[model samples]
Target: MSSAAPVPGRFTFVLHSHLPWLAHHGRWPVGEEWLYQSWAASYLPVAEVLRTLAAEGRTDLLSLGITPVLAAQLDDPHCLSGMHHWLGNWQLRADEAAASGNVALGRHEHRLAAHALADFEQRWRHGGSPVWRELIDGGAIELLGGPLAHPFQPLLDPRLREYQLREGLADAQHRWGHTPAGIWAPECGFTPGMETGYAAAGVTHFMVDGPALRGDTTLGRPVWDSDVVAFGRDLHVSYRVWSPKSGYPGQGAYRDFHHYDHATGLKPSRVTGKNVAGPDKAPYDPELAAAAVRRDVADFVATVRQRLIDEHDRTGRPALVVAAFDTELFGHWWHEGPQWLEQVLRELPKAGITVGTLEGARADGYVGEPVELADSSWGSGKDWRVWAGDQVQDLVTLNAEVVQLALDTLDKLPRGGERDRAADQLLREAVLTVSSDWAFMVSKDSAAGYARDRAHQHAHAVREIAAALGTGSVAKARELAAGWCLADGLFPALDARRLRRCRDEHTSTVPTGHTSAVPS
Candidate 1:
């Protein structure tokens, strides 16, 4: 008999889909433009691929985490308008390019751009309609929820954390007709007390990075103090697809993200030479890229198949490999990402890998011994330096001060008419203060200045409320609350009573030892 090991019982793909709320707000390098681009390049296209697979009767399993912020934009009337206009603009641009170029170049550009626009509108634009519902109904996609604004939970005030979680769940229910069973945890930023919040919110599972499991790479399992389960992304298998240095997207044959032409502001070429100048780009051929995609898919599937066999041989249990990545990396960052994804899903099952969603693995009886998760985030270096780095020191300090101010103000307020309003306002300001955007922007160095400004803006609101409470300036407090409400639009269901309850509950249950907020 051949000595080949049995195939893995399951595999999971978790795609975390998020973009900041950017309808009428910031644009260009940092705001709504980011939203539209991701919609065009990633969200719309990814959804189409899943839908196509389902149409073909291939329900290859996947879990998708669409942040509440993105959901809000998706269902918002204003954003719908903006996105439609943006698509029309893209079509116009393609038309202009086709008219101006040599026949061969022009025709190719026109066909590709028109195909993209048509596909986006046909699949994703219907409101509360069937795009997401089709996937959910079909068993192809498991929806994962996250906080309203994607806050870093470990650093948030206890009360505000509950508000963020509860409101996020509620919003998901409002949009999708069901509560999300799992959350993406807004950057995979998990801390010890977060399980309590997840438990309170009725979330049964969440995604955490593999390093959080110490060296044990497992799939869906439980964590300390939480009846809720945690699924760790299997980095060994995932890194092969998109590691920092050697991901499939970085291959010389793929489309280059960094070398787009500034004048046309469009990517016109394949990644020719690593050292080639930006403007001196070569042409992109979908046929050539398709060949590369097939090779990468074969390599990736082989890696997963081998890793599962190796783990089973060593552990005497059916092994699981959970591959997680940012949803945007698919189409926005890598032009052929959607194509690769479709091919990989179609190919893997034939290789004897049972594709599974996180929930599917759990349902099949994968469970872990309870363990305390170290503070962690899946960022550069897989540590807290991104959130607490020197670049964002001032914003971090401001966040801490604002959180304290909001908490102290809530503590001082009596339970009743005016005091209730004041507490709610403080809670809103506090939740906005803890948004992960500021720290993320600073860490990426993409828009550090804008992030700093936003943090200070929210902090100023918190301070204004604190000052009003201290001086007993009731009228001023109400006015500031009204003004701040416009900018801090998250957590619409925030309740001050919940904040008070969490504080009272936690006061008597403090851990014996304290760990640094920054995970080692």
Candidate 2:
């Protein structure tokens, strides 16, 4: 007699790792610190865990969303030099802490700093691309590409939107010698007709929040008539471990993120309690944190298994459950997060839940019928309000003006003047101005000033450069573009002439269904 097929179903973790173009910008309390901290505490440890799993012959483990902007910084010479210097400073700070008689924190920090320094020298000396290339080439992780600078697409000029998505994938191809089929869609932000752009760029699948699908995220659904799939994140499975109210990271036994040792620049306290002050929290103990990791790992595994089993039972078909999170959460916000992740990935497989990438899930026949996706994001209320709301309406207008200015200037360049340095840099500045990070900051009220200032600064650069090009002084235009390029030069692959061709082609190609606006 034939046996019934097992139905526990598929599971995968999607980590969207991104930061603004912070290199050569501010350093101390804001910019470079953010980069180095996430590098040391998050990227390094997470990469280590994935590599370890790969060594055991595991493949298609998770989908990793490394935005083009972040990849540029990780591969930039200036940022790598700064990262090295920062690691050296970390060691010296640890020595100072030890000299000041904080032996426990001092010793712990010293080891961490030393290990990070060695890791950077040995693996990251060439930059993060090679590290990612290893995983991608080995089939250990699926790469999810995004727009040139993680732009919030809903409010962007259609011409600029197509250019950004095309160039972003080109950026990935230049780095890894292949194009990605899926994207994270910068904060999971989307609206109707964006699917036409996705199809134009050859994107096959992308992510959205569960609420975007009205909470029916058990499978991937096509948007309208477009074949490009929209994968809804399983928020119940994800938020159970990182929600606003309660999560594993909030346990009193885990290391506290908010509290830090002012001297050594390291966190040395446990959460202690939900309402406890940072200064009053207990000293962090590895044993206790380890215990919490174990418990949380078990709890999370149970959650994934139960979610998969329940969905399968209801549908009589295996479902795909993707738990997505910010990559910075591991080792950066939650110190033991990487360890917990390693455990989750390892345990899920043993629990009869197949751990695989989204591509893998789809290949294994985990897909559903098509549906018209609503305008939504993974932000507050699964809507475009976070990137287009009244609070960020100023940024919305600014992005519109900058994108239009960029396209008009690039479009009007004297026939064959497309490859001009001024034109290339104008596109660069304009792309940076549209970065989704700005609206995200304003919406969340976190570093709103910095975000606004960055957006305006880039927009101003675009305006000034466009004005210079209009002056008939090609020399002065080149000078201005070069100056800005020195500070904000990313996307080394940006070709004004090539983009012009694509822009011209894409303009006529945009379907009538391709209208982009905020949905009320």
* Candidate achieving the largest TM-score: 2
* Candidate 1 global CA lDDT score: 0.76
Please give me the total number of clashing residue pairs in predicted model 2: 0
Cα lDDT tens digits, model 2, 280-318, are 889888888999899999889888888988998888887
Q: List the residue pairs that clash in candidate 2.
A: none
Best by lDDT: 2
How close is each model in CA RMSD to the real structure? 3.6, 3.0
- Give the CA lDDT, 0 to 100, for residue 85 in model 1: 83
lDDT of 1 at 22: 60
What's the lDDT for residue 211 in model 2? 86
Across 1-520, the per-residue lDDT of candidate 1 in tens digits comes to 2323438567888999987656555778777788888888888778889988988887646999988878777776666777778877776666665666634444665676677677756765664236787788787789899887888777665666676788888888877776888889987887777887788788888988888887566546688867888888888888888887778898767888886544445666788776777667577666788899999998998888888888788878887789999999999999889999988887778788888788777778877678888778787766677877777777767777787777777767765443356567777766666779888988887787877777777678888888997899978887888777665554455667766655665432212233364544
Clashes of each: 0, 0
What overall lDDT goes with each candidate model? 0.76, 0.86
For all predicted structures, in order, the TM-scores are: 0.89, 0.95
Q: After superposition, how far is residue 171 of candidate 1 from its true place, in Å?
A: 1.6
